[model samples]
Target: MEFWKNCWNCGHDTPQERVALEFFPRIVEMFSKKEDGKVNQRVWAVFYDSYSFTKCKKCSAPSLFVDEYWTQTTSPEEAKCIAEEVKINGVSKSGNLVHSHIYPGFLKEPFPQWTHDLEETYMVLFWEVYQAAALGLNSLAMMGIRAIIDKFALDKIGDIGGFAKKLNTLLNAKIINADQHALLEVVVDAGNASAHRGYKPDNNHVKICLQIIEQLIGIEKFGDVINEIRQATPKRT
Candidate 1:
């Protein structure tokens, strides 16, 4: 079977193929102690424990992962049935499993290399907010995005009044087009809602907001940075 996983070496999503694998069902017996200081078996949990050696097809980087599956409390008979099934059939593809990297330790989502080209303070804050989003701190991450926009506007066109006013100035100055301006308004308003209105955005929403921010920072400037520059330059009469 093939699985798509983030390649630790290449920092890309790639298909992984299992090279060496072994799995077996094991049962853990839970014990409870009575008032008489006597211990008695209370319940049993059965699961399949396995070590999968997989290699990234794109980069050929090997990763050793320890995995556990089907962990739940069950009766002895049920545990026996599960154990027999696992022992005979091996690991099932359509099941819940936890994969932990044991060899190269842990890995984090890789950020784009171009993000480092941003101005110093914004660049640092951007990465911090990215980490916050990755860590599931949605509210803080949204607020951080809002703060970055505020700072970016300030750097672009002075204090430039409030948030809405800054966006207007950007539009009037032709820094951002109608569509890009509209998208920024949506994200900035959502950021405000997330900050002051107790609105918590989902991961999908955060992802979209991040994508917009990325586009704005890129050379394209969400549309055409070069055209915007031409618009800024005084045309020969």
Candidate 2:
């Protein structure tokens, strides 16, 4: 079969074709039994787990194509079932199974679109924080989060100061209220610790930080627009 996929080795999007191979069998023991007046078949038909080579039409790199087969019924006369591209390996007795390779370039969760509206430096820092969190680098993620606050203040307030001072200025300017200021202070403290004292925040800690930052950015960029939309919307009868 022919298909298109991202080639991890060559780092390109390429077309691929599967190559077929001759099959051989491995011996696995089987047994059967009878209960009451009925005959019960204990052994199912053999499944061939074979690897065929797929060459990338663009990069010419060979990837392993998995072919798996099994019997659908206990009767040997029944036709076999086939799966062309089985991703998961066979399950273990303990119920454990191995999965196929996942493309790292594809994000399972996407970053918010509001990020692009931020100033260039703020956007860069915010995306760095996101990528760090995704890669499980909690300390670096915290540091990036801290840097985002600094960049946000600089872009919005046009001043350079410590994180706490910036937060105070934003509070005085009515950019954030008392409750928001208090929450931001907590994030600032955590970020400072991660940046200066080599503290590694846990997943929950970083998640809270990301949530707060996302909410703040959303409000800052969209608050007036949201109010306008709400006013324009008709009330239900």
Candidate 3:
């Protein structure tokens, strides 16, 4: 008997053993086809309660966790719509996904706007990291070391001097190596010159700064972080 086998998501016929369906009608449709013997199939199943966990590329620690799954359906459009709607609803209910980490001082503002800004900063940081990894130091250095620090996690250190001290401490603890340490110093000096002394960083310096960050985090770890951030980032409107 010739069976009409297709992807539960897109209705695209596939030889794969299992088709993942996302909604109730799709699941019912698959079963109906099986029961009527219109299609040759052994099992019609729906994916429910599926959870995905992402691990940090550097430390291999659990970083991001998502615990929700929709019922299977035969429509890819419907599945996509459901996923997007779920994500939008989540953000509306929780403000922003990344905002969950914000504390009282800088992030505690008029709620939604504050959360949106945090999300923007996080996106920029990820872009910077990815550019550094792919294109090397030249690309990242242009943003200036101070800017990177400020954008990434420097405000948490308070003042510029304190930021420099913290970088040194990280280096000393072997959290960052010698090359990264040197790059950090250069970036701080360049940033200070630009911010306090009205001096700007040359293109070469920008490249070097990017390279330093890449070395410190490693490409694989950076990729993992980027993916996690993407997964957690909230959609606007």
Count of backbone clashes for each model? Answer: 0, 0, 14
TM-score of each: 0.54, 0.53, 0.32
Q: lDDT, candidate 3, residue 33?
A: 47
The runs of at least 3 residues in candidate 3 whose Cα sits more than 4 Å from the true structure, single-residue gaps closed, are 1-120, 125-144, 150-161, 217-237
Which runs in model 2 stand beyond 4 Å of their true positions?
Answer: 1-105, 227-237
Candidate achieving the largest lDDT: 1
What does candidate 3 score on TM?
Answer: 0.32
Give the clashing pairs for model 2: none
Query: Where is the poorest 10-residue window by lDDT in model 1?
Result: 82-91
Flag regions of model 1 displaced more than 4 Å: 1-6, 10-53, 57-59, 64-70, 74-110, 129-141, 157-162, 169-178, 196-204, 219-237
Candidate 1 clashes between residue pairs 3 or more apart in a chain or in different chains: none
Give per-residue lDDT, candidate 3, residue 166.
Answer: 74
- What's the best-to-worst order under TM-score? 1, 2, 3
Q: Model 2, range 125-170, lDDT digits (tens) per residue?
A: 8888888897788989988877777777887797757878899999
Worst 10 residues of 3 by lDDT: 99-108
